[model samples]
Target: MPAPPRNILASTDLHDVRWLRSSYSTGANNCVETARPRSGPETGLLAVRDSKNPAGPALLFSAGSWAGFLTAL
Candidate 1:
């Protein structure tokens, strides 16, 4: 899939981005947090990372690519 737009990507203020964890993780605490840029102009990118490692690196993906990746899992 194509990469996310450069402008949104460059301006990704990860510190302020809200993240969501999988409910499927249950009480294990082994889940990742994710955020999708607000809908409309910046809706193509998806940000994800390990909840336990908030300061660690995050993985970004184009919307389509992210859907495909999730489907494969």
Candidate 2:
């Protein structure tokens, strides 16, 4: 299959996705939030968005790409 798009126009475009923030996040919504699309074209892809802008666009990454990003940190 072809690769998924690099991003979605808006996080709202993803349905039924449960956004999650790191446990290390403070009360301030400064950290990024992540979610996995359980259905639709984005299924199996990781979605990330700014916590402060839930309605903003989201960056989509494959599982391996997401893992490598975290491993490098």
Candidate 3:
């Protein structure tokens, strides 16, 4: 199989996707944000970005990888 992509796409360019913040987070933009792109190349992948930089680049991860990270945390 081919390798997964590892590119930092600008979060602002990911249009029409709803960015998610943790419920426990203050509205002060001091935490991380996540999103799921329903269309385009990002589809089926989880996108993460710093809430402090909405227009910054985002890191992508597979669902299983994200889950393992949470479990290891």
Clashing pairs in 3: none
Candidate 1 TM-score over all chains jointly = 0.66
* Winner of 2 and 3 under TM-score: 2
lDDT agreement with native, every candidate? 0.66, 0.94, 0.85
Clashes of 2: 0
**Candidate 1 off by > 4 Å:** 1-15, 38-43
Off by over 4 Å in 2: none
The predicted structure with the larger lDDT, 1 or 2, is 2
Write down the lDDT that model 2 would get: 0.94
Candidate 3 lowest-lDDT run of ten: 1-10
True lDDT of residue 3, candidate 1 = 43
Residues 1-73, candidate 2, lDDT per residue (tens digit)? 8767789989999999999999999989999999999998899899999999999999999999999999999
Distance (Å) between predicted and true CA of 19, model 2?
0.4
**Worst 10-residue lDDT window, candidate 2:** 1-10
Which candidate wins on lDDT? 2
